[model samples]
Target: MHKLNGSFSTGYALLTGLMLIALAPASSAQESKEPDIVPAGETKTPKTRVLELGAKLLQSNSPLKRFDIYLVGFHPMKDSPEDQMEAHHYCHQVNEDFAQCALFDGNTADANLNGIEYIISEKLFASLPEEEKKYWHPHNGEILSGQLIAPGIPNMAEKSLMKGKMNSYGKTWHVWDTGHEGKLGTTLPLGEPMLGWSFSRDGEAIPGLVEKRDKKLKIDTSEVRKQREDLKQYAKPQSGVDDLKGKFSRPTRDIPGVIDQGNARSLPHTTE
Candidate 1:
């Protein structure tokens, strides 16, 4: 919906390019009440593009640039190959799966990057009890952990879910579930798993696994700003939002000639 390239008026910066490059289709039609529309095959207009950690993408255009930088640079020990592979799958899944409800959501990679921002903003912040403010403190390294926000699944490349319980005493607790088993009912439109952000019957910001959040769920704008700041380091300099939307509107099984050797380096199975 938003024009991605114009944001990078100064030319493709490395992080901006990476974020654009990372753009993927939305996982759902309306995620936390946002539009995710992008056209596929349209090359990104990057502000900056860089190849880091063998292969990782980030964006700097959004307001939450800091989160962009942090996400890519985090975990210097580096993620295991398995973790990396799973991460990619989850990201890819987020892109494709968003198409179920609406024609499409914004680029999933962008959305994925925003996922951190989303958690910190609307989900995590609002979820926090007014008294438990320390946990949301910026100094806590754990705040950066994808697990802290929604540990249901720790793969940014995959869809996230949240679960809750009805205690014996009629109380409730939080549970998270990440991992996609595909969508329900082949007959459904965009029959991918109920992945990504979708409201529950109760109107809560339910992760895919969780059944509900609240009626007025919305992504936190402040968190969105911070994540954008952090993610700038890994954000793609290119503007792939248009391409991402196009690809989602009329997707293909695979692009055929596009060989992702970089991704394959970390994920052997990704090789064409």
Candidate 2:
């Protein structure tokens, strides 16, 4: 036999290896399977499904409306000129021309009963005599002051919602003074409901209350104030306006009972 050259021997060995790879009993597809590929436009994860359901539920819930706001005022019988800041959570709904709100002392689930607020449409508010209007506070000041905030809402959405409430009037009465005592008293204080008002200016509210609230809610009241500058026209003018001038003791005819004198002096008044 002729002696094989090294080059030819190497070429034969390479060709044999290639043939073995091609002929290797094509491994059953089941033995080495590729990962299942999610077809284009057909992927849906558990998280996405959950988000869709949440959106649908939010759209279906119509009657329940909730907001967290701060009301500033004091006991009706107290003559001391001071500002009291009370945190309130309002769940209100409007049917026809009437609106009713359930008020809570704090914004959380553990919050206690503070009081209730009633609102009427502009037509209804207009029909009331001028004297009756004093008991109702204009919401424009509350809306524009950046003090009355609705938590868990986008800034633009909150502003749009407040626009609808601009002309609306609210008559709020506080049953519990949780700000002072720290807890809801065992029994509901017996007396006329203390009228609650909104902060109309920069210094009218408690110095740190608004700031603390803004921090907790991750909101900037200064930005809200800037956005509401155009709403000033809707606000009631301070000229001859007793309501914004620390004169909130007027008794409303809607709720029964005279102003209670004993509870007025229970808490020390803080000066404006």
Candidate with top lDDT is: 2
Candidate 2 has an lDDT of: 0.48
The TM-score between candidate 2 and the true structure equals 0.55
lDDT of 1 by residue, 1-272 (tens): 11112111121133344345454422221134222222234554453333442244353443333222111101100111011001111111112111001112222444221122112222233355656532222212212112213211122321111111000000001111122222211112232222122110111111332111112122232352344333222222111111212212222232212122233344333211
TM-score of each: 0.17, 0.55
Residue 163, model 2, lDDT: 54
Question: How many residue-pair clashes does candidate 2 contain?
Answer: 0
Candidate that scores best on TM-score: 2
Question: Runs in model 2 with CA error above 4 Å?
Answer: 1-83, 180-191, 233-241, 246-272
Across residues 1-272, which tens digit of lDDT does each residue of candidate 2 receive?
11112221232234335435643432121021111111225467999999989998886645553332223222221222253644454544445455677666454444666677886655577798877776775555556766675554434445555554555567777765544322233334455566766544345454565666566556677787788676544332321123444443532221111112233355455442
Error of 1 at 92 (Å): 11
Residue 116's lDDT within candidate 2 is 78
Report clashes for each candidate as comma-separated counts: 91, 0
Worst 10 residues of 2 by lDDT: 29-38
